[model samples]
Target: MASPLSALLLLALLALPAARDAAQDRVDDGGGYEDEEGEAVEEGEGVLPSPGQRQGSCPSSCTCSPDGAVECAGAGLDSFPASLPADTQLLSLQNNQIEVVPIAALKRVPLLRTLNLQNNLITSAGLPADGFMVLKELQYLYLANNKLTQTPGSLPASLVSADLAANFLTAISPGTFGGKPDLRSVYLHNNRLTNAGIPRDAFLGSDAVETLILSSNSLTRAPLGLPPALQRLHLRNNKLHSLSGGAFDQLRDLRELYLQHNQLNDRSVDAKTFTHSRRLEYLDLSSNNLTLVPRGLPARLVILHLERNAIAALDSQGLGRLRSLEYLLVHSNRVRAHAVGAAAFRNLRRLHTLHLYSNELNRVPRSLPAHIKVLMLLHNTIHEIRAQDFAATPELAELNLSFNRLSTKRLHPRAFTRLSKLASLDLTGNQLTHVPVGLPASLEVLRIQQNHVAVLGNGALSGLPALRELMLSDNALASKTIAPNIWAQLPSLTTLDLSSNALTVVPSSLPASLEYLYLQNNRINSIPEGAFSTTPNIKGIFLRYNRLPPHVKDMFMGLEELQVLDLTGNFDGTPEPGADDGEGGDGEGGDGDEEEGMGNPQKELPQRRRAVERGTSVPRPQKT
Candidate 1:
């Protein structure tokens, strides 16, 4: 299509009688490319998977290139692979098991473009101060999924696309990408970056960037004064506390924008904050701490993420201005779930995904758009969910209504009667003692964690013909309570979470697709011989935080490929087995079984948590 489009193109087919000549060339050494045993990144694609793909092979730590790039990605490289000769154009080392990338290793390839090392283990690129000078012709560098501590590389003059997501990097040097005038596509999501340390001039001169993603960082201020060519900006999951109205006034041509999961307190985003982004099409501001929505954005805004905030109610006067806005997310805020204004997003005719989970909603409000596909309202104070509430959105596919204050009053028997294409429904975290009847037959994932479900009765899952994941954890379904035919009913069930219940024995009734089973924090004292006799494909199990009797002889059974078993916080005064099971008694007494699974138990976070009801939630539903 165009310059950048040509760079992202992949897979070209050879045609006609020239095929014979191409085959002849393949027979010779100078022949185009040798048929390697494994598949490599198809040339010219925007991204590429690593050797561990279904195609497999190459050393676990090695980076393999198919575009005649031996020096660029060969040998068991634990670091960033060295560069190759000028002939090498595109280089991809994605999904490799690499650990670290030594900065000096990349200087050898001066003409390299499109360097993709995503999903690799390299922590920090550690580029030398002169790295920009050494790889002058390099472009498109992807460094996602690593343990980086800081930005280790600077931008080259010709560099364009860049991705540094999911790293430990804490800051962005201001002058890093100063003068790259034609640079485009910058992705830095899921990092530990901050604003004070960032050079104010980091993006001073790049005038051609179309997309800039800096989500999941620790930024405090909005990086304003961007080039006129900027289009998309992603800054979700940051630590931003406030922003002056003129923060993003420079980007007049901006389109898509994401700013969710940040500390967007009362003073952060004013109505005029995005006044310069008039052409915006997508906007996400969910999971922030905003108390009110100040006015002053474009009427053409689309795709809003305002979930998990402190907004108690909507000031209709403010949200009514956006006539073209679509996909509004106001879930998990201080607003009463039933207090939503009918016209909140009535102008959004193209809305698709709506998230309103973990709020004070007692029931679904009326006047919902009919085109919604994904609706989330789980973990709230909602007392009931009437099927008629969703009649407006007939095209709905998935619905989440887990962890609420609702009691045994079941949802509308025909709750999904109008949802012809409904696929998934979650009704966890409530006072229900059984499965609801309104779930659609086309459902796939049903998460009913942390409820009073003591058994699976008649209408538990009557219409679900294609359910896959069933989360019945934190309930009272002891060994004999879960109907044998309950799990057997869903042929596609794969993940079953029954942890934190009163189950005393594991049931043999399980589906063939079952892969993960979580049975931790329960009264289960032992595993019977045929606990998993039927589920041969099971892979992982969590037996941590339980009381297993000492007299029991065997543990997990029939799980041939079972990868992990969390036995922490469980004890019967067993001796050390010298394994990393983390088992030991609650006290540091000689009992070793209780310590097995607690070795590396993830520490609790300070964020507001959804409190699953005890006998309904795992970990005994400690109050949040």
Candidate 2:
């Protein structure tokens, strides 16, 4: 026998998972916009009903609970239901075809605190004048995803949160939100709001309004005279071109601000624009046209996103005061090696992650932060790695240098010796002919795919006992040049990818703990008996698009845990006269051809195997 207030709280808690799902969909489909309506729904508090509750009458089309909660959602009603519950406190009518809000019907439930009319066809003209002024005890009003051209002229004074997103609103009168002292959150995103449509004092008496979302609008400039108690403001995906000085001087409690995907530049922004927001923590200015980093950022900032800009240089003065910064993303810019000052990042002692990929840098930036952990420099023009390049950052764990011009001759022998804690390294799409020496013994994942690597000499990967994953696809590897027992040194190896190579046969002496082996798109013609004898724990073996002959099922005799054996696109003991050599051209040795033969058997094998019997079936190979 719980109280009616407790039951209403339980119902609100049950709706949170659906709200989170909707929020995630908005974030993914709306181009990285924050979902403020979801937060408003979570923080809404309903009013308590008076004592001596009554079991009110229920409508035939709605489900009524003894706690004064009624649910009539998604009932396909073209008009509002005629409810006669006098003590009802919560009513949900979302996902319906109702076109009007009957003022006479709502006047019956004077104790209503929460009214949800989302996803309806209600228009502005259909709402009667002073429709919501009767429910003086209402606190939460949700009218999102409607056909309203304007907000309701009058609202209750006890309203705590209102959601008007995804509407056709174009203007807001000065008194629309005035005289509401308890109002805190208002959502107006994905609307047609313009700069001139909003008056200067639109939020005049809403002194407690903290979160305001005006993103996805047509505003040319940020709104002036915002509430002083604002904490989070979202203005992304707008047409803003400039910001005047003292624009945000009143919002002293602001913490998170989003201004991405706008038309801002260096000349249009003042240096002291954000100097008043001393407690700001997260700022996103990505996808703009600025050529240099903005100056005069707050000192207590923690995360800054400046990616997808036209920035070309970094000076010590631009980022000298952000000592509390932890994450910095400047990728997809025009930054070069010489343009970066020597002490540009020396002051950021707490920086942990730095992303400089897709730039014009020819070398690593000088004076990197000492405590950095993750560094991404892929898709650059860097050709060499000096010995003392990583001496300043000893705590590095992950480094990605893929899609660069790094060659074996230009890379120093002791280039990565100082990175004792390095665990993951990606050298994909390079020109290295052999494995680099002096790799850290603590490495775990190594990706050298799409390179010109031809040989794996002895002692190349000897000391790496903690290595687990190794990717060598799209290379010039052949069975004769690979050193014997080269993979036995890695005792903890689990996955090995060698697809799209020039190997004529399966490499021997694999690790005993190997679980997944990918050897597709090769020139292998026969499988030697006991080819996988040492690796008894192997679960998946991919030999698709190869010149494998029939009667190779004996290779999987003792593998008790064998789950997947893909042998599609291989010769079925009757070779065609003019058939091309396997998916990756002849096994002689150049960069292998990258054709889409059989389409990544690892991902499609499970479904294809169940549809039709295309490959030979081993004795105990379970279908996965």
Model 1 residue 544 CA deviation in Å: 9.4
Q: Candidate 2: TM-score?
A: 0.85
Candidate 1 per-residue C-alpha lDDT over 1-624 given as tens digits, one digit per residue, 9 for 90 to 100: 444324332311112113323332332222221111111111111123232232222334433354423222333444544333333445556555566444444544445565666555554433344444555667666665555566654677787766665667677765566678768876666567777656667777788888776765678777755566778776766667776757677787888877766677766767677777789877776677776665776788776667767877664566777767656778768777456777766766777877777667777767776788888877677776676888788888887776677776656667667777888877777788777766667778877787888887645766666888888888888877766667677788878888888887765667778888888878887776676777778766676667875333234432445545555555564532422222333311242232232321121100001111111222210222
TM-score of 1: 0.55
Worst 10 residues of 1 by lDDT: 604-613
lDDT of 2 by residue, 1-624 (tens): 988656765676457335533643474367432222110001112233363355346877887777678788887766776654777878888788777777766776778888888778878876765778878988888877777778888888898877877778898866557678999988887778998888878888888998888888899888998888898888888888887668789999999888888899997567788979999999888988888888988898999999999999988777888999999999999999899888889899999999999999998888888999999999999999999889888999999999999999988989888899999999999999888888888899999999998888888888899999999999999988888889888899999999999988887888888999999998888876667888989988888789876456446555777767776677654533212332322312234333242222222333333222334443342233
Specify the highest-TM-score model's number: 2
- Cand. 2 Cα-lDDT: 0.79
